[model samples]
Target chain A: MNAPATERFVVPIGPQHPALKEPGHFEFTVEGETVVDATVRLGYAHRGIEKGAEGRNWTQTLYLIERICGICSHIHSTAYAVGVEQLAEVEVPARAQAIREIICELERVHSHLLWLGVAAHDAGFDTLFMYTWRDRETVMDILETMSGNRVHYSANVLGGVKFDLTDESAVAILKGVEFLEERTHHYRKVVSEDAFFLQRTRGVGTMTHAEALALGVVGPTARASGVARDVRLDAPYVAYADFPARIQLLTAGDLEARFLARLDELLDSFRLIRVLVAGLPAGELTAKRMPRKLKPGEVISRVEAPRGELFYYIRSTGGEQPDRVKVRTPTLCNMGSVITQTIGHNLADVPMILVGIDPCFSCNDRAVTVRRAGDDNGRAWAWADLRRYGIDYYRRIRN
Target chain B: MDTITTQSPPRWRTMLDRLRNWSLANSPWLVHYNSGSCNGCDIEILATLTPRYDLERLGVKLQGSPRHADVLVCTGPVTRQSADRLRRIYDQMPEPKFVVAVGACSISGGAFRGCYNILGGVDEVIPVDVYVPGCAPRPEAIIHGVAVLLKKLQPDRAEEIDRLLVEAGAVVGEEEGIDEPNAELLGAR
Candidate 1:
């Protein structure tokens, strides 16, 4: 296995690879079977969503923002709505807040199950993938029945929520949660005790708490490394203050801990949903009056997405449209850990390590071009200039 | 190697061609690429393969490489960075290939139409045989899109199959033992 010190071999995966469901590129410098170094390149899924948000009004921007990540669509919209509500000084009704939390927990159930299935599939365990995805349909059904859409459930409005939880839907949700709870218990057992599955996860991609903190990982990824870093607990948003979620933590920072941590959070989500539904707040669904234009101010919204903390920075210029909108999705925070942790592991474990953070390329790929003041005579570009630049850039790419 | 001829093939050659067509029609291996989707359409496409929708029941298999795929299932609006890569993937697929644009984003850019990084839709880069339009199409709609592609694959035989189904319905109206033939015909494809 001894090779020349000067010889460096690198392996590139995706933008389009079977292992990656989304589009992203990664380069791993390997020595034989072991990875010597790793680097990542993003922006493959970048669609200029932030820039698009700036031109649209607050309400329209909310819809555009929801499409940022389909898996955590509600959380994105929730963050934006909360920020807008703050800027507008509008009070969201308690009932709407509880409903938002309920949907959020249900989304967590669907998202975690989906991730479990995909992770299992990546580890050469198709049976687990089938079983977990089959179980995931229950929550999907609940979401569809409640919100009228499967993936991008437009449940959040600016002042409050779009739909109210009826008695029938509430009962259905409780019943669905009961079934999912039992199934989750079985999955928890399988993830923790199944010996064959453990070979892929048990000690793989192990990140110490210190490394996690240094890398600044967030959400369940950080919690698995024994870091108390959930936005729901640290700074409660929506109805989390009323129906607090018990943070799920695991000391082992390996892939196994990530699995167990998400599953633990799934179980906690079930409990949280049950409590919220039982003590369902009764009030108006939205505020009485919401102004078309928000006051001139800036606000930052942070919500714990399925993956991690989703941050939104919104600036209003006392117009119908926002002056600026910037989103920082959770995948961006956890992406650095993948590069640092993959070093020294088998190259085959790269996908498993990448999936450990549940990396969403679409969520994180927000590209911004920077120009120095000294360059190009420090000329300021107009909107048309930027448009022409975009066109010329692609035309050059095509040619 | 055989040279092109205006005359029809022999009986055995014709039978072999029919078998090949049937096999290809039944098993349309798919290679999915996400140009710049929000992950909604991509995940829905995955959900179709899982147990609930069970797209595999129709003999559809998702392949890893474009060379092995008969159908290209594309989601998302084409991004500036991914447009060339997407075109390259389309080029890499074997001939007689079909593309199913699965999502509003892939069809006409949907909600992300005017984004600076987006290059409209899948059709902007490659020829699309089918388009399933939705913010994110439901699993049923995606399955239908695949079925439509399957029909397109056997355009000549589709009418014949319909005629046979109608005849089978009439025969069932007359007597029993019709179900066996219908089931066999359904399973044959």
Candidate 2:
């Protein structure tokens, strides 16, 4: 059975929804079960973070900006610190740079693990979801041992990191690494072998290389679609210059391919962390002192977050606070392609399509309300109307 | 190797079976919801399942969907817009659910307490079962919080609901505002 040729069915997936974990509205225009058009709405979680950054001093703002997104907190702080330090011409110690790299890589590990679990759940593989998260905890524990808190490590200051990795902490981290490596192997097996996962994800939500580039998709989403774009490799930031990044590229643009790409990236992060921790530099963890005032200038910083390329454009005004802090998260770019990919897919596959980008609506917050052409037919068509129409059409055709 | 049957099970039957099993074990699948916060509690919550703390041995798994998860691990102070989304997520989870407020912010807004954007704590909008107190609680503490939640999930623990209501006294009514209660006032808020 097909949708009525003259009428289009519209489905509003959120402002609140079971399939979506974050707050954002998505409206889909469907022909039968296929999504003919999709529109996303965000800003459901806007907190005036940029405005808040205006009044706070550079030091206080460091802690403030890190709270932008819990998963990407460290990178936000890193980007902010990098901007302020650049403006002040402050050189952080080599040890602190190395420490920043370690923490960033650790954050990537945890974020990817969390994403894996979420992706698995979207495909209804609850066991895989659990296993990936269980493994993710090791990375979080390592961060906690280094810094007092697990989520907001508070390790990054304007000039350098606040906490140094003691011998005990270092040993504890190495031990955790050993455990993670073993767990990752098991995850690799399960992710590959599970038939239901393969059925749900394979060839679903395919984003081709051309489409990904045109849409400005970044990070693993872009890489999964056969684009070799990684900010860490292209523009080395912090200690990224010291360690070579082994970027993982996948040719398949399917959901499974995206899942595999994230898994591969997680393994590479593990290797990078080992190198960083082993080559621990001996020096001050923070710079001697940063200038109280910044020079008036504009600087743009890009870092490869767990999701993809995270861009920060900061304009300083020779004051304690920045004049403007504009952030363009990876999800913002990746979200554009959801409509293109979800079309021609089954209704059951909608969540999989949404999750193919490892969407973090928390970071990319904006929801668009969609209005279609010709909805003024003086009739409101609910989801039930579409279902009923489909059922009746099927019965008539069979008869 | 034996090939498994590919026939789709009836939806109602499958749901009933899974529900029965889930009720018996009370296995909570957790989906970590970040509104806006420092990464402290988010990291510590992740640590709970690592080898040192290893929360998985207790049959708890972190889930991705509000639909599948029995517990929602929410970290952050509720921002104006995120409050609506958080409420939607809370509504999406299947019946007999629990929320774990795992950080000082999730429990009582922590360092960002008086900040303009923050709504203080998660419980300001939704019901919370366990509160792990720390600027960011350690992984071990997070694990402990989860264990406490698992206990509350038991079918026979109806009395715990009253305990939570009692603990969240003023806020439960209109006496206290939607701003989260402080950690010191958590047990007697």
The TM-score values for the models, in the order shown, are 0.89, 0.75
> Judged by TM-score, which candidate is best?
1
User: Which 10 consecutive residues of model 1 chain A have the lowest summed lDDT?
Assistant: A390-399
The true-versus-predicted C-alpha distance at residue A189 of model 1, in Å, is 1.1
True contacts kept of 1: 0.88
Candidate 1: tens digits of C-alpha lDDT, residues B23-136: 778788999999999999999999989888888877799979999988899999999889999999999987667788989999889888998888998999998878887878
lDDT of 1 at A394: 56
Per-residue accuracy of model 2 over A33-91 as CA lDDT, tens digit each: 77777776665565556666777787888877787777878988898888778878899
List, residue by residue over B1-189, the lDDT tens digit for candidate 2: 011122576777567655654563455678777666444565556556544455666667875567887778887678765787788888988765677787777777765666556677898999887787776666655665665555444435534533443343312433543334442333212
What TM value does model 2 have?
A: 0.75
Alpha-carbon lDDT, every model: 0.88, 0.74
DockQ of each: 0.73, 0.23
For candidate 2, please provide the TM-score of chain A on its own.
0.89
Interface RMSD, all candidates in order, equals: 0.6, 4.1
lDDT of 1 by residue, A1-399 (tens): 678755768898988899999999888898878899987878889998988998788899999999998999999999999999999999999999999999999999999999999999899889999999999999999999899999999999888888999888988899999999999999999989999889989999999999999999998999999999999988999999999999999999999999999999999999999999999989999999889998999999999999999998999989999999989888999999999999989998999999999999999998555688677755656758865986796567434
